[model samples]
Target: MQETVRVALDAMGGDNAPGELVKGAVDAVNAKENIQVILVGKEDAIKAELSKHTYPKDRIEIRSASEVITTEEAPVTAIRRKKDSSIVVAQTMVKKGEADAFVSAGSTGAILVGGQLVVGRIRGVERPPLATLIPTTKGVSLLVDSGANVDARASHMVQFAKMGSIYMEHVIGIKKPRVAIVNVGVEEEKGSALVKETFPLLKECSDIHFTGSIEAREIPHGGADVIVAEGFSGNVILKLYEGLGSALIGEIKKGMMSTFRSKMGALLVKPALKETLKTFDATEYGGAPMLGLNGLVVKTHGNASAKEVKNTIFQCVTFKEQKINEKIKACFIKKEENE
Candidate 1:
């Protein structure tokens, strides 16, 4: 029998709240037979949106939440004060074992804070990291500590490398994923104090395949399957990568439309180019997951559209099926035993 994965979705969160969020929930249920979505928000608003869609009645549910958490509010304070907020309620469901996962396109701080406080962490996890998959020429690479743990220690980076390798190998279906630390230069002697300290520890890890340093320029060429860094550096690399991809795509379009002769060439390449670009659309893989949590917590873009929301919801199903949390717990426990 297939295990049903129940996801508690924050219906009142995100820039396109209630509308796109509701549509995404409906779309998710329609797309997957073993998935169920519990929409948490104002009952009237949720029902009003649901009235417009045609979906399986048994697969979608509604839970009333009175308040909504905003991005500007401090994370800890907002979570403490807004007990009835959609984000908190959804996270609570995961903590209580009522749901297998929590998904939100809400405040990043709130999600991270709530995930650690509400959903809790796996037993041996010192610090949970936000990991996202970035598109690469070979395929996708897992970026650990993407926007979490800004002031991480060498021990944290070492943990990040191990967890990232596990994620890529299990969830992403890669055999012996290559792990690399983000560095300015390839030399063993280069990098900051933290990277320098962390490098040797990662090298000593026998479970993961440490492939030395990976410069930012080589990331696009698929130099490694897992990229490790502290939150500050990882976040910067992520933003730069996103901005560059957008700019390059825009320039390609502009160049293709500049002259009549180019227009004919553009028509010839349009189909192939469109197909090629689809592989790079990060939304296809869903949101960034906060790893090491007791239950899964995924944070999507604040302005995510229905497609992104839907994809994230489906991603939850795969996570549950793979028993990722159990694997993470065992990995950390075994490491502690060895130490």
Candidate 2:
């Protein structure tokens, strides 16, 4: 198989590291013939995990990293003190251009911190935001800064919209994706000072299909293709979305089992409902990418299965092939000059 993309997988990262993490890396390599994976972590521990599988030897290799970064540790301190940790080592591989991308399921804060501080942002990028693809009624919407840039400004919101548009258009193949700033309401005067200022900025930008403001309640209906917001609001909205989905599923399951009649009906409709709900599961979307950086960094759930891990790895291929970073820089630079 011709290797087109080489990814650095943090074998020591994630709750299931060296086990699920190692298995995920091997599974990704097995599924994608053109992709190669370099596992970074304790060699012996990684070997123990790999021993359970009979993967092609050429497709996977383990790099040594004695220390492991814990999710409890502070992002800055962990990155600095745990130089030999798998997460740190993986970033090193990406920084040195030895790998095309890096994937971690351990500490999201560390990944975001390392991505900007270590991998750094592209020239002209003010602040990099973590972007995630959320499944919606109309299909999927890209949420910009879902977990980064908590203190972003209106200018930053405008930049997020533009950068997100480029990603959705070029990488996600959503031509002319409607970009909207997540606000308290659709009305121009309905938000904190930030939303009010960002509304006109996004509307004035001719490059993106600015759709004005999007309310959190309308997010599940896929109100916009690219939803832009400061990390604070975005994070709250996303967490609620995930929580609501879980709570709904639980209620439906319990309600169906309350009586024989409902149980039978549920049995008949279980397959369809399960399939439908599966699409909304956050884990199904894999990790979120930290955009505006010089290189790609994806953050997956700590309990991510091999399937989710594989998706996160494949996501990098599109980011690289589509030249998302280059296009994002161009979009902002061009938009900036117009202002």
Candidate 3:
């Protein structure tokens, strides 16, 4: 028998739980040739969802869990208490090497805490940042520490740059990614005390294509290939980017239907407009991966559809095949020695 990519999914974790989650697992299995899904949730709930469509029994299986982890629960306490919760169960599979990866749309806090506590980090990985790929005017830029690593040290930001560059190059297929530290000014002297200290470090490093600082205003113009920041700023940037893109698309849509002349113009430009705006839609890039962990872990939106979930699964295949974590450590350690 050939080795297969087995993913343990937390079926009860997402906003659309068991329904979209289970549906997504089935979709991933259907789309990928050698992938098996072990859905962790109430067996009956999974069965009910599966009954809605015909699926290959061997490809999709459900593991029963009695309790669900709500967002309200304290993450550490919840992971400790809800031993049978879908999130914990899914993480455990990765720890045991039974599954190749784990995907969750559950509590972001719980998932971040669980990934480190359960899956553990790679050797010498101090802070594993949540890295997401963002499309820029030039192309896609990998934004590191997009959710985790708040109140970061200068060292963490440095690591984020190195890891982000490795991910963009190996997994996302960007070569010589221009790594930039997000700042209020493009100059090294500008930014918070943290950014100012880290600016010089990134610039002095040879492993990454460390460009100067990138202000938020310049992100849309394809200013940088990888934007490195602490989680606080990166999260704000990520949310704003998503919001701005959605708002722009919404205005375009409403405008298209406003008048007969506008309607005809919309019809003429529909295909090109869609192709252009598709670049801005975050879902097209798949979920953000919690990089530097011992095993592959991706955090999708709580309301992710089957398409997003499916793309994330395929991303795992490439992340693993590319040996992204190993490459990151090598790049970082080499940079460290050079420093």
Candidate 4:
């Protein structure tokens, strides 16, 4: 019998609240046979949304969470005070081994705090980084520490590279994922003290194929498979990437609808344009996974729609099936043995 993957989703966490969250959960369970979703939030709200969809009763379960964590509240304070918050309750399920994974489109701070305090970290894993798959010219590349560990050290970046390489190779099916540090220039000497120190360490590692450096401009062009950086710079790159993609898409639509000549061209190329744009859609890849945690914790965008939520729930299945945590533990264990 296939082991069922139970995903506890924070139905009240995102902007759309129970509606999108519940729909996503329902869609995920209906789409996959060996998956189950335990929606965590107010009972009435979730049930009201669930009522809209006809799904298998056994696959979808609801666990009431009286409180909801907001973005304005201090993450640590909220987690400590709101014990019954949907985010906390869902994460607690992961810690208690009741659920295989926790998916939330909540406050990033709250999720990070709950992930560390509640779900905890894998033994020997010093820092868990937020790993997001960014669409590139040649498919996708994994960007590590995009939003977590802002003050990460050189050693932490090395671990990020190691863990990232493991993920891309195992889950992403890249034979030898090329790992690189996000740097100002392609030259080895042109980076912050942290990057300069971490460069040689990555090169010394026989496990990953560490390419020297990747400039921000080269990122969208598929420069490397695993782009490693401390959270501050990584977050900047991510925000700019998202903002630029959105602006370009908006401009493209505006141009296509401007004049009769352009409108005719648009009608002729709408199908092909949509197909190309779908490749750049961030939602298609699902949420970012906080790697190195004992149990999986995925953090999606707060404004995520049902499609993003649904994809994120399914992403958890692949993470569990790949045995990513086991592989990460072995990577650290082997490193310890060598030293």
The C-alpha RMSD in Å for every predicted model, in order, reads 1.3, 1.7, 2.2, 1.2
Better of 1 and 3 by lDDT: 1
Instruction: Score residue 213 of candidate 1 by CA lDDT.
Output: 97
lDDT of 2 by residue, 97-117 (tens): 888899998888888888877
Model 4, span 1-339: residue lDDT tens: 877999999999878898998989888988999999999999999999998999999999999999999999999999999999999999999999999999999899999999999999988788899999999989999999897999899899999999999889988889899999999898878988888898999899898899899999989999999999899999998999899999999999999999999999999999998999988888888999999998999999889999999999888998899999999999898888888
- Tell me the whole-model lDDT of each prediction, alpha carbons only: 0.92, 0.85, 0.85, 0.92
Estimate the overall C-alpha local distance difference test score of candidate 1: 0.92
Per-model TM against the reference: 0.97, 0.95, 0.92, 0.97
Candidate 1 C-alpha error for residue 316, in Å: 1.0
Off by over 4 Å in 2: 1-3, 333-339
Q: By the lDDT metric, which is better: model 2 or model 3?
A: 3
Candidate ranking under TM-score, highest first, comes to 4, 1, 2, 3
Q: Across residues 1-339, which tens digit of lDDT does each residue of candidate 1 receive?
A: 899999999998889998999999998989889999999999999999999999999999999999999999999999999999998899999999999999999999999999998999998888899999999888899999898889999988988888888888888899999999999999999999998999999999998999999999999889999999899999998888889889999999999999999999999999999989988878777899999999999999888889999999888888889888888889999988998
On TM-score, the candidate that comes out on top is 4
Candidate with better TM-score, 1 vs 3:
1
After superposition, the stretches of candidate 3 with alpha carbons farther than 4 Å from their true spots are 1-3, 329-339
Q: lDDT at 72 for candidate 1?
A: 97
